[model samples]
Target: MEPIKKAYGYVTRTHKGRPQVLVFQHPILEAGIQIPKGTVEEGESPEAAVVREMIEETGLTEWGKPVFIADDRWKADDGSIHHRHFYRLDQKDVPDQWQHAPSGGGEEEGLQFTLFWISSPGDIPLARGHGDYLPDVLEERPEDGLGCLEPSEDVKQVYLIEEGVERIIGETREQISFEEGGTVLVREQTLTSEEIGDRRTVTRLMASTNRPLTVEDSGGGGMRAVYAGDHVIIERDGGEKRVPLHHLPVDTFSVELLLRTLPLEGTYALSFHAFNVLKGEEQLIEIHADEQPDGSFKAKVRFGAMIQWYWVNTETRELLKQSSDPAPGLKMEFRR
Candidate 1:
């Protein structure tokens, strides 16, 4: 049987020196996430077809030459042979995420697509066998760990607000005493209760392969946490619980270090485990960063019912302001 020919485009970019590939999903939830690809016309060459598919599917115009990578045989659900041609097409003129409605005629005509870049293609949710050729093009997907955490000695005051009135809850401090050349970094945080005026809680996290982000140990307020393989074992109130590690966890005590060091651009969204001492276990948290026209940034973070916003100077990556509601009718803010 003559193999049905198809061309796939791996639209790529170097984001913060990290090679990332573009992928999209149809607004229709069941369409599944996928890359730009199309069937070849009778006389259309693979190269030409790939270029046409890319422009039609992604609505991207500015791009470098599409480098052909390989030809593979894939079996379709109907047991038919699919002769797949893959190409690495580099593009720079796009945002981290956007909705594009393609005018290309066919079943998908006028259907909206949501496009975004993924540093690790493997992380694509329900990928439709569209990224099998990544190894021939991009560097190995980075391990799911803190990229590298180097915390500076800094202290900031925290204030609690209700309806609009603000008061000093306490101050949080971060410091790096001694780290032996990026091998292993010990991160320590100090939190105090202003109401008690005499009690303090100290929490320490460890992340050295890349960031001072914690993946190891933290303890305070009648709870102790330590890393045990891929899970964090927590001992609280005479009971033990384990939370599986997804993305390395980060907490309020450690977010300042990350905000100062993270690569902020293009309204990118990132996820991590959020560990709260007050909460029972680790939960997923998301941070969305939007780069402003002046090269500054506004980051929005969501964890459970609480949402936090931060404004930072892009040049220094310093937090200029922050606001969040820690509880019902209660707000917390920080400004510099």
Candidate 2:
């Protein structure tokens, strides 16, 4: 197989009042600004190839002496591979007269050009095939003192749990406990009862996690209950259903810690929505609440599907309101 050969050159310069770096605009690609470079023809010395490529591409005649940067193998667009030689030319020697070569092909090969000054290695965009060589150049000229030219920060670790009443905030696992003494409203629909009598459905209101509280029946005629992170499984119910928890709609979940600690008074609004995971569609349910003088609040929530809404007083660890709607298939209760 015939060996594939190509060459390109890059220029680095310092911008006045800005960082010192090299700049070159790509003629064909949009937002293509980086070091100028092109391929070398066959039988040409690597150094001579870079010189000729730079002159032909940038119109710079006085390209100065080519400084060898590195030599490595690379793959080209034609699927053939070749060894590449890289060199850097000082911007000080750039000739005043330089122009782009006219395209041998017609105008459909759109290309544009621009110039910029660069100081540090990080100032160069990684796209122009110079991404790898940029670091080497910067290391060789650390004294250039390019400001704001550094690698990005690493992502921090975090812990996320879907179940539970407490919002886990730290990176480690920890238990959150709540004390007693709170109010609970139980709503039941019964055909034979006084409120709505024989076939009756009852909803108990309480404070738990952001989702509804569920009571399961154990197989042995016992009962099992789960809310947020708390679970109690007896011999009664052996089934389990997972519910989603979300804060009142008005409060936008953000990375800002202060927003999470803000007092829940006239501060925000809440909305409920039904999410169909299978279809990736959502329908909003209107829910409203107000803070009471005793540091407690109340809200009425409704979703297309039976879902639970709980009002847990963060300060006193109380369940303020728990309710369910038969029409929506939601069941909930509260205990303090």
Candidate 3:
């Protein structure tokens, strides 16, 4: 049979003085751990194919040029011959780990992969001989300051919050869906309790590495946002307004939602301007994270004089508990 051309990538970086290689694992346990690789398309050079495969399979939006490494030919179990080109690309400034349902056709269309870095690929092993060429291309890397913390991969979370004699129940789900344009990452959350006025449901959607395209809060004055060009078109209280969102000088009003996705390190801090959807006014918000002695993490989500503590698991990134005393004599708690 004629040979099928393919390209494979060894996306490498440094975290805390250790050399690391990027890899992924399919949700289906049998697929095993893997590196970003794919079949080269007709008329496409292997170099171009390498980058395209890395982006599509690994969900990386930003990357540098790839350096050609080596080549090999192998016969598949199906008796088809395959020619593979391997390349190495350096990566920078990204979260420790993230999840994405690759954008493409074929058996990968709906499969989600948990993408992360490992100091050694052989330790965990990549399925289907995906690591065959690792010994030829692996190299020590200089520190990139990417930090060592990795968010857990769990997509479904449930939490219970309490205050004084009152309680609030919250549940969140994270997933990817094939939409009109392509794959859209979605986070849906619901909040309810015996509290008289605290029933809320929020849905957030993001395209690629882009900021949120929509943030719908059914409880907070019916606040909603739609991405339009470089600005966010917000609809509320029978009126609409637009606000600018940028890439650099990164700023976000969706701090609470972002915490679920950001990799939490021993120390994390960011200050940005945010629109108070409930107040209909712009305000400054600050969020900080620090590792606890128990290996879990806590983030201070403060708004005005009220501060809430978000506790998350170190390895799983699961929300273990959250508590806040918003007012005198009132303590609120949420436990998973």
State each model's CA lDDT, in order.
0.66, 0.41, 0.62
> What digit string (tens of lDDT, one per residue) describes model 2 on residues 1-336?
454555545565534533244555566675466565555666678788888766655656676777654444444567675566666676664433333543322451445445555566556564535554554444343232111112121122222223323222222111122211222222222122232222322222222211222222222343333222111111224443333323221111110111122245753455544332222234465545566676665554444443545464646433444544444333323222
Can you write out model 1's per-residue Cα lDDT over 186-274, one digit (the tens) per residue?
Answer: 55556565563433344443332222222322344366654422345566767767666554445554665567567787887888766
What TM-score does model 1 achieve against the real structure?
Answer: 0.47
Give the winner by lDDT. 1
TM-score of 2: 0.35
lDDT pick, better of 2 and 3: 3
Runs in model 2 with CA error above 4 Å?
A: 14-21, 93-110, 140-336
lDDT of 3 by residue, 173-218 (tens): 3322323323234445544444334444343333333234456777
Candidate 2 positional error at 236, Å = 64
Worst 10 residues of 1 by lDDT: 208-217
Count of clashes, each model: 6, 45, 9
Model 3 regions more than 4 Å off: 1-183, 197-200, 207-210, 244-254, 260-263
Order of quality (TM-score):
1, 3, 2
Runs with alpha carbons beyond 4 Å of true place in candidate 1: 1-151, 196-220, 246-256, 272-280, 292-294
TM-score of each: 0.47, 0.35, 0.44
